[model samples]
Target chain A: MKNLQIFCVIGSLFVLTACRKRLDSFLFNNDNSIIEYKLDSYGGELALDIPIDYLVPNNDIHLFEYQIEDEGEDLNISAIFVGDLNKISSDTVILYCHGNKDHMDHYWPRQKLLSHLGEQGRFGVLMFDYPGYGLSEGEPTEQNMYESTNGAMKWLKNNGLSDDRLVIYGYSLGSAPATKSVGDQSFVLSPSKLILEAPFASSSVMVQDASILNMPASYFVNTKIENAEQIKKCEVPFYWLHGINDDFLSIESHGRTVYKNHSESWKQKNEVPGANHSDVPTFMGLEVYSDSILSFITK
Target chain B: MVLVVGISACGPAKFVEPLKKFENAIAIDVGGPMVTIPDVASMPIPFSSITYGHGWSDKLTLHGSWYTTAAIFGVAQIGAGATYGVWKSKRQKHGISAMLGFNTAFDVYEKNFKFWPQLDAHYYFKYNYKGEQQEDLLTKNGRKRSNLLYVGVGTWYELEGVKAHGEKQQDIVVPMLNIGHDLNWKKWTLKTEVKLIAPFSSNENIVLDYVSLTGDKGSTGVYLGLIRKF
Candidate 1:
């Protein structure tokens, strides 16, 4: 019996170790630097090289690199400021939370599009990389993401950006922190408006959708971000945009669920008929996409 | 992060089956795979199994068993197999059995199936009584009234069918050492086994490459069951 007990203890430890290792596998990170771009004037024709920066002139945008002290760790955060620095105090700022993928560099084009929303240079767009993404420091976790977002929000507040002049825009993975900030009272100030594009409903819903299985999320993961539950408490005007043919996260399961959960009286949804995930902007065309967002923010 | 926790909690591997069968008896085993270390922790998954055996002749028996675990996160498993036993003792006591079986683990979207072929050999030692030594410990009514202890060794080979994304078919061989006790009282018999299974070959790392965890090279587990003789 004693020998059996000894053996059992050893076995249990082995299983726990394996579980810890398994936990580390969910995060996929890459450290490739953001691509560089150069501009040159040509014979009376202004030609931009990259597809992303077509509308936004290079001189109007500034890239800011700052350090955020989170949980005793100093993490590097990369952000872009679009519009004049002097107008930051007076203009409504859009806190753009981007989706998961390579890093902030990948979403630089989206930031350019957002800068022109509601008339040219009318809104100042602030977009940054979450920790462990882009040139940011530390691995991405729920707690770290929240902390990083809070740090960015605080920096904006300290620089004369107030709650009434702020609009939160979350895309894909960015929706977690965006909804969390409004839903959980994580931030001291509430934004004027909330926008979710291709938002996932929650971790459980995501697992079920991805695996097409009836298994509970708890069996495999402990990350529970219930966007539907959080959106219920949002009091600001809510605008949701989703592609009808999004294969990664289904429109019915995720986008619609979150929209239905919001209790805000002023809530709207735009389901692009032929668009899929990640191509809504290109599919809607710059005119329609920009006009829709401009109208939503102005209204 | 939530992703880390999500990856850590997935997967259930096959457990050792101590090859013990009674002639002309039906047994049900109610237990699950367990891992020991720091403290004993079972898989926390629910499982039940039933086995039946019939004596074909004095030295031969045919048996079959089916086992299944309840679904968690849409994950469930069912296994069924047949065993051919050859008794060495004249009374059909000590024997070796060869088994062929297939099992499947599935979720709502994906299914994984495996074929298992195993060979188990055991020697039973009956209790010594004060007076008469009965080779066949059965009463006039055909009820068993003896206790037996057995030690066995088994080897199993498994080939799995790949169905999940990023998963590939795996072939694994496991060698196991088991000690068991069979208690017989009237129409009811109880069997319990302690098994130590050594991992001969496994592709757990390749299969769970997205996660950092891997299976142990060797592990100890236990199985307890009840058998009814007709």
Candidate 2:
């Protein structure tokens, strides 16, 4: 019995160690690679109707790469900023954190729609690829995600943007960095307001959804990006948007929990009907979606 | 995070045929629902359980099981059940059994737990049985050999009034259907089973990619068990 007990303990430890997966690999589907971001030229599935004037030439679209340290190694992070760089100091900027899809090329049209938020180029919208995404170098870790978003914020700050004028918006997986930037005290800059679309509550919620039970997230994943808890510390005016029909992360389990947990003073919620995970913008119609965000920014 | 939780009670039927009075058996089972891992082929999640059964009478057996997989994941899960033989042939070639059971899981993380009440019934047919203890059928172990094939239907009730994050729990009762074969070698039995879990529950909207033959509903589970009879 003693020998059997020892074997059982060792076997349990081995199983525990082997079963855990770094959820970033599964959560972030950053598989596609591109030599250049062919924004309008590359026809992707999801698109919004933007006026021809709002295209690349009319907007000051800057495609640049910034450097960040990932575990002591220097990695290049790719970014795209829309609107006039010269007016960044005076303009309110929205940093668009894209979801866990392929790359920025797939999200270019969405950011283009944001560029026309209040009026064409009224607010500079900046979006970047997380590490191992698109043209960015190094593997995509949860730490690297926060660091990359911080790197983008630092770049915007270097170009004369301030916290009060910075608006951080995250969708789906991007909610991790966006919530962290505002909620985490150690973060470089806290944005004036926070916006999340179809945000998942936490890794544990995902595990619960998968199991339909209160199974611990540590069983299968080590990523502890709990946006629900983070939103409690976020005192900024919060804007929560979710699709009623979000199948990947249920609105009730993922989005509503995050929205409800925000103990902050000012908050707004938009529960769109007939919208899935990635189609909230298109489902709400481009003009309506853009106008809704404008109202939040001005509020 | 597609950890297969719905297959939490998956193991061989506690007893296809109840043992004679005072007999006992211990079993170890492993396997679970199939899930398609991203960039990897579909496979079973390998949930495991250890069960012990004791015969109280010729017609009834009591059983309990510890969920080894859940324990490994830091969740304590256990189940208890009783099987009553409803009918049996004079030659012991066929039998019918009914079982009632419950499995509960508790996690220390948030002090959260859940209970599922279960009911199952099985019909079994025994074949190629040798009466003598010295008879060797498939192996050289000098043990009486027999084979039992059983088909069963079961359902587990979700007792929680609310789902994760206060969502009204819609699926209260999940149904399952299973078919299994047990090879008996006197004091040893090897069991293999295939189950259709939640045959009517929609697989859509869940993060895991379940390989279900029931169109868009339900998932298939596979299990293997070894039993030592005393």
- Displacement of residue A276 (Cα, Å) in model 2 is 1.4
The residue-by-residue lDDT of candidate 1 on A110-207, one tens digit each, is 77778877655778888877777766777777677777777778867877888888899998778888898888877855688899998878766664
Q: Which sections of candidate 2 miss by over 4 Å?
A: A1-24, A32-36, A41-54, A70-74, A263-266, B1-30, B36-43, B48-90, B94-123, B127-145, B151-177, B183-190, B198-202, B211-218, B225-230
Query: What's the lDDT of the predicted structure labeled candidate 1?
Result: 0.60
- Compared with the true structure, what per-residue lDDT tens digits does model 2 show for residues B1-230? 34344444456567778877899998899988777876778887778888889999999999988777766655667789999999998877889999998987665444456677889999999887544333643445635476899999987887766754455666777778899998887789889998888877777666777777786677888889999989
Lowest-scoring 10 consecutive residues by lDDT in candidate 2 chain A?
Answer: A13-22
lDDT at residue B74 of model 1 (Cα atoms): 33
Q: Name the best candidate (by DockQ).
A: 2
lDDT score, residue B228, model 1? 69
* Model 2 lDDT per residue over A1-299, tens place: 99999589646644543342334467777845678888888776443455556565544899999999999999999999999998889989999998888789888888888888877788899999999988999888889999999999989989999899999999988999999999985566689999999897888778766655444565545577889889989999999999898878888778988999899779999999999888888788877888889999988
DockQ of 1: 0.06
